[model samples]
Target: MTIRVLLADDQALLRATFRILIDSCDDMEVVAEATGGAEAVALARVHRPDLVLMDIRMPGTDGLAATTAICADPELSGTRVLILTPSEIDAHVAQALQAGASGFLGKDVTADALLDGIRTVAAGDSLLSPLATRVLITRFLSAPAQGAPPRASEDLGALTAREREVTAWVAEGHSNEEIGERLFVSPLTVRTHVHRAMTKLGARDRAQLVVIAYQSGLAQASRPAQR
Candidate 1:
């Protein structure tokens, strides 16, 4: 299946460049383009593309707010957002993920990496494997925003024991294959459990599941052991 993409960037040159690159891919197609955040939100609602290539900074609504709006809309729940930014600032990454972005990529990424990221996010997976991303999620996303009202997490009682285990593994940044190996199950089985967890938790995607796992303290972040 061809993955439909909506490009949202403030720079016309960058958008055109991305359009050319994405259109060259056989499995992906650019369905729409938005120059600002509000326009991105509106286009996403209208096109309901499989993914939106969102820029972090934009005029007016901005990428973070646009991501929130798109993700919050039940009609556009199936659409995923992949944040594209020039910098890998921890605070911005946390906010982007919180706003429902499935992945974050630097503008300096190679064409192949960018395409792979689009495909990865479109396939219901998150591209947060980089160490910086891990640290950002661990340190920032786990804590409640300052001065923000305390919020209650969704009940995890709806998930079975195995599903909870799978979610924790996911939050810890384990891929399906890695989780399957740990659990002595097939990758497909692990994926099934992940999907079940997401459904029960009402998560938009695997990224949201990870966010919830960390925010709810069901999983704790620790530094990766030295290789």
Candidate 2:
């Protein structure tokens, strides 16, 4: 299926350039465009695109604000926001995750990496452009985690034993195909299990869903989520 997308940037030229690259991809389409954070949020609600490309700094609300707003709403749960930034500072990267932004990419990324990041985020996975990832790791490691984590899936009490297994794999960064291989199920089945988990947890997308798994103590790196 073609992934529908919204591109939000303050620069009109920048937006148009990215729009061309997005529309050129056979499996992706630019469904809407926004010049500011507020416009991005408003357009996102109206178009309900699968992914949003948000700029970190802008007039009106700002990409961070728009991402927070969209990610917080239950109605806009399926939409993913990927932040575009010049650099990754600790404060911004940490804040973005708390606000529910799914991924980040540097503006200087090659066309291929940019495409890959979009597809990754659309597929319920997170991506940090290499530069962004390096900065985040350094900062995240240095910064002291300030608050308690988000409530876990167990608190939701909507997942069955089997569904919890799927969510655990998700937290470990396993894709549907990878999870299916480990579980001895078809990828389609993996998707079903993940879907069930999402419904149970009331999660909007995989990034936050994984966060829930990690924070809730449902998912760990040492072991896959087991039924």
Name the top TM-score candidate: 1
The segments of candidate 1 whose C-alpha lies over 4 angstroms from its true place after superposition are 130-133, 146-154, 221-227
Model 2 agreement with the true structure over 127-167: per-residue lDDT tens digits? 74344333453345223346755463347467776678887
- The residue pairs found clashing in candidate 1 are none
Model 2: lDDT to the true structure:
0.76
lDDT of 1 by residue, 121-155 (tens): 99988878746446777788778766653234447
Best by lDDT: 1
Q: Enumerate residue pairs that collide in model 2.
A: none
lDDT of residue 66 for candidate 1 = 93
Q: Where does model 2 exceed 4 Å of error?
A: 1-4, 11-13, 25-32, 42-50, 73-79, 86-91, 116-149, 225-227
Q: What TM-score does candidate 1 get on C-alpha atoms?
A: 0.88
139: Cα error in model 2, Å? 8.8
